[model samples]
Target: MRRFVYCKVVLTTSLVWVLVDVFLLLYFSECNKCDDRKDRSLLPALRAVMSRTHEGPGEMGKAVIIPKEDQEKMKELFKINQFNLMASDMIALNRSLPDVRLDGCKTKVYPDDLPNTSIVIVFHNEAWSTLLRTVHSVINRSPRHLLVEILLVDDASERGRGNFMKLRGAAASRGQVITFLDAHCECTVGWLEPLLARIKEDRKAVVCPIIDVISDETFEYMAGSDMTYGGFNWKLNFRWYPVPQREMDRRKGDRTLPVRTPTMAGGLFSIDRSYFEEIGTYDPGMDIWGGENLEMSFRIWQCGGSLEIVTCSHVGHVFRKATPYSFPGGTGQVINKNNRRLAEVWMDEFKDFFYIISPGVVRVDYGDVSARKALREALQCKPFSWYLENIYPDSQIPRRYYSLGEIRNVETNQCVDNMGRKENEKVGFFNCHGMGGNQVFSYTADKEIRTDDLCLDVSRLNGPVVMLKCHHMKGNQMFEYDAERLTLLHVNSNQCLDMPSEEDKMVPTLRDCNGSRSQQWLLRNMTLSM
Candidate 1:
């Protein structure tokens, strides 16, 4: 009886162990299948054709040709949507985007405790299909638990509900953070997580997604490769430039980390609701659209908050040349007035440079800046100079320098002037004036000789030495001032300046660096003008 009992117990135990192994195998197999779907859905570069030639006269491989009869409708739609709305609808947008992130970006795991977000999409005159698609895309893609609400602020759009754009404000929202976006854009998968995660790390950190471009014509989603930081010219116009060497070096070649920008493109970004309100939201005096981006960036950086662009999140925007909406005042007038307020409130002594660049604004009424100025003092924000020095040292205008004057030939004593000169135009010496007029130049620590939006450059082999728009990178725009030789040597070509013959219309040529007197240039007098 004991032997029989032992055998029976062994058989029962063996059967139980086999059942557990079978169950584990089935569970893991199902998990792997789910992972496969996610892997395919995450890579936009590998999905679909990605190359769509649906608009105008063009063809991509296996193009989904738009019928000739549909061309006029497309033109009308483009005019309305400021994007290829027709194509956006036709393309299989129920898809993924190429993971436009650095290798390191994928390594991060967003915290589960991220704050709820409300997406605010403002539209003036937009297409219904694209607008609805945007709403649906967010609803479908975003985690339902994390998204508090989606607010559609229509600025009197006549397209969908006819009068939706005129709606003043959205209904009540429940989100801790609010994201502002244009109506004509598509959000990629895993977009909201990264943005919300960063805000969770620091509530005062205003963050932006890596903005990708959706072609206005082709409607193909284009990935933005160069992760350049946003900056502005002296005119407060926004521009994207390569990462400064110093800033990049701090990363140690890690592209996944968030990049600090002096300014942002302004339109599409996420901010803490309280921080936005606390830091004084868009200047109420400002017009419908213009200079608001720079204004907000300045306010945030100054008022104990920070702004950054998160590389992991991606959103494709339709960059249109002409906005569909109309400004009550002329667009230029509104922009000038808005910028005038920006200068008054934050620019400090550097505001004088505004008058020098656009003297008309000095006369035009910028409205009362007393309230904005008072707000700045109340916040006890850092001065614009501190922001410039600490945040953006690569800037050209009003930066650090020992000399600010004209590059003059010792023999002729003529100022190097390139005003109104086109590419390859010969740079000639004009009389030096103390006013630091257009001919006046500034020699920066980076060895760039610049003035009036132009930099000293040389074209192809032995080409005319001319003034070109500053590229702010290593190229013709970069020059080496050999103080020992007293000559301007082109960094890339290793060629020194040479004026073979002394004539009024003579174009300087680049020749071997033999250190000739014609090539020698000296800073006659340092003029303190930018």
Candidate 2:
């Protein structure tokens, strides 16, 4: 009986081993099929890991190079956005950027209870990678508790009024402060603290960031100069000029101190929520985006507020050569209309300077500015002259001038024209157009024959009349207009401005003071503001 029980146990054990072997073979076959599917599906994720590991294109703010085979395709895609779309696509959305701040800024500390901000980003059909990158950079860099939320505004309405769109964003915000940033920008490390800290100290302070350059072609990040600030030309166009010596002295040569700028680029800034509403958020009547920056700047300064550029804050912006979006009527027409509204409401008598610089604006229908004028009056704002005198003492616009009109040569019947040239370029003479623009010249109390920010300067005996930046210093730039003789005499060289000859390349020249008609000139539409 014992032998029979042993035989049965052996047979059962053999059967159990065979079943286990069959089960193992089936499981191995299914796992091989699953492995094949995962290889195909996870290829993109694996590449992403490799890219991060190897430091991919545009990593660390470096420029991205396009392969030879992709050059033509890149060119074609560039037109769609007026930027290097192909290169932007190759960059990771959360790409790393260098810490491009001053050494002092790196160690700066902020209050733990700093005011939280609701960032307002406005865009109209921007590229996917750039837009996402902007959002990601902001999220990654800004302190979570300090950032309430980001409101992405779609200003792509048929009217496409950027001012109105921003107003909507400001209205919807729930944070203590409202920060406006452009759609194609990257926030650098510690960019938010300095801005909010300033506002927390002074609610009426509207602060801006030092905007760095992000190359539109190579997708490379570049640091902009810390020595520049925003200013406006006579035509109300925004410009960047070097920080003056007076401002540097005020800061005591500290690179980390906030810069007191006359105007802002209007793209990236932060303001207290209640203060924004109290001072009037923005001109709803303004169209699209053109003169809003200057409008806000003037209103802020005149209405008991300060505009500043915090030096410790740095943000990268993509500077495109041309805009990709279309203007409703025409680009020039829309901008002219917007400028006219701001000039009429905020510029006071100085509006004449804008009208004279851009005569075409005289004909544009700027809609009704009665409401804007009412806002200024309600705020009991200071006059434009006060702004120029107290805030922007170095303004290009002369407070006191003998003449504000055209300078025409009697013999040639041509006007002394700027010809849209820059500083140090030869001054040209064009047929009198009667309309202001390049023909306008201002003989200031300082005795400088100026056009816009340029002065008629000639140091050599018979050198080509050149346009030097009005130095306010009375040396080569000093000129005396002999109203009796109708001659313009360069005081330093004692030479008169003569009409250009054929060999002069249409550029005016300086000659010994002669009473001849070639040296005689007249000021058309001249008005005395002295």
Candidate 3:
């Protein structure tokens, strides 16, 4: 009886062990299936978990309307970041943004073997909500396998500037590519693939997404124009101009194709890790954030690499009217110092134009740029003339110009001023200040008297000398300055740019050419390079 009982116990124990093994096997198999699903559709899983559809503040990229009671509070807090921090706090961290891409972009297919990237975001005392939202949006929208890591570089200085933070992040980054993004930005769907794909295809290509605007007041997502590409004024401030017809024809009107840009907005872009290093990354000598975008843009184009804006990719950034942060040496001083370094290194002879436009920059001691100059020499980069003629043919900086400086009337001793005006505004004369800004003008090789992007134009006889957008066609914009006669003859109007008449004390007029003192003008500091 004892032997039979022992055998029965052994059999029952064996059966129990078998059942436990089968249960464990089934559980692990289900877990493996889940892992597969996550690997395949990680972005969708994130969207399901983090994205919300119910109507709320900042939902679907709609503007968040502040209540009447909160207007005063909102205004008070807006000064902190030059943005509506209160509205940002109210919005969900994972707020949904609209897919602001063209239909053709949506249908496009990128290579499956695109390289992974490490996003480097540099911030100094950035708002809590906007900073975190930038992170969450990236994770929720980008594919998991494609985004290796997100590096938050906080180079907050007591002086309220960021210095060499990006270099530090690049050194620590482990991904195949490094993408730099602003602290207050939102990544949209499929933003990663196109950027990475372009870098994979040509490692030398530095690509930027079309940056959309997030309203500073109400936190509304507004689509930026894809037709616009980056350019810079004479002050080296980045500006957007329409994509030239030459580029449109080159791409055969395919808006989805990458547009060759002269410069980038500097906040968001992607570059291959090895290629970035090979191209000699950001200039270490550059202080804080100012002309780094143009510096890199010139470096890329001049050093046999191409800079482009991938239209298929879109990211949203808060466009602030002014910076809330402080500069150690004041904003103008810091920016001037930074820009002077770029001009000294990259602009070559073109540096004269910058100095001629911003005469004050000559006094600011730009630190040593020998290393940067050495880098340029080592790269065997093309000259600035090549860049202007080939890469940015339509650049506002005239390649060949007869004169660049103040246009002063001999009699009134007043200078022809842009008056800080926009297109079609009547051009006025102000007391010659000798300081450049509103008084500066360039007599270009194209025979247009240009200031920034506008030219002195007069279409009809005795028409007010107005500042019009410089049309290269030069119908009414053409002017011939007779150095012997000291008169500027209008080509189309058959008149000269006369000084402000007794009747019109502020506005300059176009009258029939006479060698009168009012019509007599001097191109101060004129260089006969033309």
Deviation of model 3 at 39, angstroms: 37
- Higher TM-score: candidate 2 or 3? 2
TM-scores, in order shown?
0.71, 0.89, 0.88
- All candidates' lDDT scores? 0.67, 0.83, 0.83
Ranking by lDDT: 2, 3, 1
Candidate number achieving the greatest TM-score relative to the actual structure? 2
**In lDDT terms, how accurate is model 2?**
0.83
Model 2: residues >4 Å from true position, as ranges? 1-54, 526-530
Model 2 over residues 1-530: C-alpha lDDT tens digits?
Answer: 00100000111224323322332333234343345555344345423522453278898899999999999999999998899998887887778999999999999999998999988887765675686578768877998888887776666455576777788888877789999999899999999999999998999999999999999999899988889998988888899998999999999999899999999999899999999999889988888889999999999999999999999999999999999888888899989988988888999899887788788888889999888888899999999999999888889899998888888888988888899999999888899887778889888889998887889888888877899998888999988888899988888788888888778757888888879999998876643231
**Residue-level lDDT tens digits of model 1 in 156-213:** 4222221122122222344788887777677877888888988989999999988888
lDDT of 3 by residue, 1-530 (tens): 00100000111224323322332333334343346544435334333323444466898899999999999999999999999998887787778888999999998888878899888887776775687678778877888778877777665445644537788877778889999899899989888899998898899999999999999999999988889999999889999999999999999999998999999988899999998998898888778889989999999999999999999999999999999988887889988999999999999988888887887888888899999999999999998899999989999888878788888898889888888899989988899887777888988888899999999888799978888888899789998889899998998878988887788888988888877898998987643221
